[model samples]
Every structure is written in structure tokens, then in C-alpha cells.
Target: MSVLRINVILFGIGNIGSALINQVLESQQFFREKRNIDLRFPIITNSTLAFFEKEGVKNAWEANFDQLAIPFTIEGIIEFAQNKGLENVIAVDATASSELVKHYIPLIQNGFNIVAVNQNANVLHIDFYKEIRRNLKKFDKTFLYETNIEAGIPVLKLISDLYYSGEKITKIRGVFSDSLSYVFNRFSSEDVPFSKILNDAEKRGLLKKDFRDELSGVEVAKKLLVLARELGKNTEFLDIKISSLFYDDLEGTNLKSKFYFDADILDKYLEIAKITQVKNEVLRYVGEISIADEKLEVKLISEPITSAIGQLKGSETVFEIYTESHGNVPIIVHGDSSRKKTTTIARGILTDILKVAEKIKIKETVWL
Candidate 1:
């Protein structure tokens, strides 16, 4: 059996990052034996430091990172690849940092495909989004970031297929955030304070370090924008009307320094839950995209406990795709990505890598 070597340069050695590395390393034998592919991680980076080795990491990447990783920059990473004559390079961005997004164009230009687990690059200004796609085409590189929407769900590909197949998709709607799903599900069912659920979600790593980040609804809105764009809509992220669960309520909370734990602020959610309960409805944070009109929204909405969106439990995310053919019965794609978020995300990343690898294999066969 012949083996095809593909190099992976990983960024962000945080939770998801570490999980992906372990998954890749552990599954090496399986990939090699079954798929005839060898994935090599020549570089693994945190925000500032990186572990670089030509032969790729082994079972001791953690120790290697701790003992041998050195400070590095994006330029240094690019130069390292260029000097090493690396090909079939896939750059994995597992960071939540917006600053790291600026390097994506450079990496693509320097012969690197992208597999981003972050939303920053995909939900940037419309011009930059177009530019990135344009660069991908011009450079003949693939960019896949299915983890941005819902890691275990195939909604992105579903939307893309429906759009390309000439389906008249009128709307795409559902609970898009696992964190928000977990937050709202508990708030609606439990009589406990909303802060308790929020605090618990934060501890479980379902939320950003700052709980308000997920509650702002921007993350979910960005996800909506991503899907809309995938379905051929030119909607900008700013155009989406985000019905925030937290940002507007706080007196002095911006994104950077937002960590409000006031009892008064959390009371509104409790009140909403109680008031909605009288009507036999529960609250859910959801995103909806109307392709016929190109309108997008992310907000806290009320649904019957029996309804699909409302029935979502603890960190479950669902996506419903509406089309002319489907009529009353929309295609529902649901997942519980938050149950094992990091592992699911790691699987998603590997799936994307295989997509690229499959393409390379096809190209090689055609050439031969």
C-alpha cells in the first residue's frame, strides 16, 4: 500500500486544539491502514509559542511542546513551510482569536489550505469574505470549517447541496448554538435562577470564558451568516438583527471586559421563563435565515415544549432546512455537539481533512 503524506500546521493549543492533536496522533495507524494516508503535524502552536519538527509529533507532543516549543510568528510559520518545500499543507486554526484571522490570506497565498474551527474568518466583513473565497480559487486551495456551525451536524453541506441542486430553499432555521441551547433549556425547565445555569455552562466549557460572549447572540448570528453565505446569499454579518440574551441588558458590559454576575440582570431571564411557561412554551435561542428575502436573525424565541426547537435538551443544536419540495416537512438536522464538544469538533476537523485528502487522491488518480 502506498502512503500519501499530508502536513498539518496547527494553531491554538487550547481545548479543541489539544483534542484534535490527540485524535490525529491516535488514529494515525487507522488512517494509514485503512485510508492509505499519513497525517503529519510538523508544527503545533499556541498563541505565542510553537513546536516544530520535520518528522511530525508522536505520542509525546505535550512533553515536546512543554520542553521544546519556542516563540514564533505567522511570518516565521509561513517561512518555515516555504523553506521546507512543504506541499499538501493544511493549516488548522483552532483559536478563538480574531487577530489570527489576518494570516489566513497569507497562508493561502503561501500554498496552505485552511480548516478553521473559529468563526472570525468566515464572518468577517463581506469584502474580506469574498476576498478569501477569491484567494482560495486563485490559489487552488480548499477551506473547510464545518466546526463553526455545529461540529457533528452536516447542515453546511446540506445547505450547499440544496442550493446547488436548484432547490428553492425559503428558510433555514433552528437552535444553532449548543451553549445557548443548554442555557435556555435549563432556564425554561428549572425554577432555579438563570445565573446558575449560565455559571454551570461556563464551567462545562460550553461557553466562552466570559458567558456574555455566547449570550450576545453574535456567535450564533455569525453562524447564521456563514450558512446564508454558503447558500449563495451575500448577507453581511452586521446586517443580521441579533436579539441578544445579555449584551443589551448589562449597564457597562462590552465584549472585552464583560463578566457581569448581577442578580438583577439575571432576573429578566427568570421572568421571561416564568411568563412564557404560563402559555405552555419554553424559550430557545435560535437563528433563522430567509433566503427568499435574505433576512437573518438570532434571538430568544418562545416555542411549545413539544416543538422541535423547544424540545432541545441540554446543549443540543438543530438545523431545519425549508424548501419548496419539502413544503410542510422541513429537513431537520440535529446534533448534541456539546455532549463531548471537543471530541466532536476533533472528529469534524478530521472529516474536513479527509475531504481535502480525498480530493488530492482523485487528482492524483486523474493525473496518473
Candidate 2:
């Protein structure tokens, strides 16, 4: 049996990216011996610097990347892959940069499979999204973005599977952001103020560098748009009506230093919580999309503790799927949504990489 060598070109060396590298290295021998495949990373990069080795980067490449990696552009990296005539290449995008995402189509044009952890590229305009799918079909390439919707859970795959099986998805609803989940879950269970809970989540590195991205409900809206678009709804980000948990003017304020200074700003949530408590309900930030009505929304709602959305604990994300087959009962997909530690998200990326590899192997066998 001949071993297949799948070259990986990774973008971003942050938590998830670094964890993916270590994971690939850790599983290198196991995959080689058992699966008859060699997973090799020829390029690893951050925002400013990149490490490249045509012969495949060794385990100690991190030290070399730190000491000798050079500056690189998107074009430069693609040209290097072109010059090397790399085959069975998989482009792994772990960055959140919109600029990096712009290179996805070009990468596909060059015969590279894609596994993206970032959601920005997938939630583009409907035309661009269609173009991406068209390009993937035109080039005979695979693009897997299982980690985009929720970090670890296979929500996208579940939807795709259901759709392919002729099950019509009538409505998709869930809590998308684990950061907001932790905030609201704690706010309801504990006696802490909403502002204090938000501060604690920031301190725990649950929120993004820009705290507004999480609290503003924009990120959850993007996830909902991606899900809606995947369900064959021709919807864009603007289509989703997001009811943010924070005040509108909180964007320009110095949230980093004065996060706890303005406790009264979060009083609205506390007031709602108190009212909900009286009604025997819990507060949760929920994302919902009605496929039949062509509606999408992400908002904070109050529900009984026994409800699917209210039973969530910590930063776990829960997706309730309503289909023609399962009307009142929903197919629930629930798990931790926190990407700070990188275990689940990294595993999701690795699963995508392996899936691509398996496809390549099957194609090779068919060719033989």
C-alpha cells in the first residue's frame, strides 16, 4: 500500500492554529502507520510572518519559524505552492481576517481543498457564497467548514445530512455564542449583576478582543445567516434581525478599563431577569431562523428552565432543528461553544482535513 501525503498550508498561529499544528504532529505517526497517510504542513503563518519549507516542516519548525520566518503575502504563498506543483493540498484557514478569507476562491482555483475555521468568508453576500460553491464544483475540490457554525459540534454536517436525506428543515433555532451563553446563564443562576458577569467572561478570555463583537449580537447574527444560507434560504447578513444585549452606543466607549465602572448600563438585563424570575423563566440569548417564512433573528428571550434554550449551562451551544418529520420534537445538537482552549475547534478542523484526505484517497483509487 502506498502512503498518501497531504500537504497542509495553514494561516494563523493563534490558539486554534497552534493547537492544530501540535495535533497534526501528535497524530502524524498514528495516521502514517494505521491510516497509510502522511499529513505534512509546508507553510504556517501568522499575520506578519510565515514559515515555509517545501520538503515539509519538521516538528521543531516552531523554533525555526520564530527565528527565521519571513514576511509573506497571500499571492506570494500561493505562487510558492504553484511553483512547487503541490498536489492533494489542503488550505486550512484558522484566521478571522476578512482579507485572508478573500484568498479562498483563489486557493480553490489553484486546486487546493479548503477547511476553514473562520465564518467571515462563508457568510459573504449570496452571490459570493454561490460563487464559492460554484468554484468548488467547477474545480472538483472540497470545501469543509464544519467549525464555522459552532466550534466543535457538527451542526452544519447535521443540516447537510438532513437536507440531503430529503428532510425539510422548517426552522432552525439555537444559542450560537458560548460567550453570551455563559454571561446569560450565570446572570440567571447567580445573583451577580449582568455587567459583572460580562466582565468575568471577558477576564476568562471568552469574549473577543473587541467585547462588542460578542455582546453586540453581530457575531451570532453571522452564524445564523450561515445556517440560513446553508438551509437553501437566499439570505444575507443584513436579513437577520439582531436584538443586541448591549446598548447601541457602547461601541465607542472604553469597555476594557471601564467594564465594571458602569454597572447601571446592564441594569436592563437584570430587570428583565427579575421579571422573568417572577414568571418562572430564564433569560437566554437565542438565534432563530424560520426557513418557510424566510425570517432570521438573534435576541435575548425569557423561557421556562425546562425549555431547550433555558436548560443550557455555562458556554454550551444548543441547536434545535424543526423539520417536517419532527414537528413538535426537535433534533437537538448541543455542546460547548468556547474556542478559547481550542480542543473542540481544533478537532473539528482536523476532522475536516481527514475528510478531505479520505476523498483524495478515494479519487486516487478510482483513477488507478
User: Who wins the TM-score comparison?
Assistant: 2
Error of 1 at 232 (Å): 1.5
Worst 10 residues of 1 by lDDT: 251-260
lDDT of 1 by residue, 1-368 (tens): 58888899999889888998888889999999999999988899998899988464454888999989999999999999988987789999999889999889999999899998888988888889999999999998999998888789767877888889899898989998788888778888787777777778878877778555577777788888888888777788789998776535463545424444455565665576568564778878789988767689987777888778878887888888889998868898888654577888888888998898878777778888
TM-score of each: 0.92, 0.94
- Model 2 accuracy (lDDT, Cα): 0.84
Q: How far is candidate 1 from the true structure (C-alpha RMSD, Å)?
A: 2.4
Residues 1-368, candidate 2, lDDT per residue (tens digit)?
89999999999889889899899889899999998889988888999899988354454877978876999997898899888887899999999888887888999998889999988877888888899999999999999999888767788999999998999989988888888888888888887777777767878888766676677788888888888878788888888898876664454568544545555766764666566564668888888988777889988888788988889997888999999998979999897654455878898999999999999999999999
Off by over 4 Å in 1: 54-59, 247-249, 254-261, 268-273, 276-278
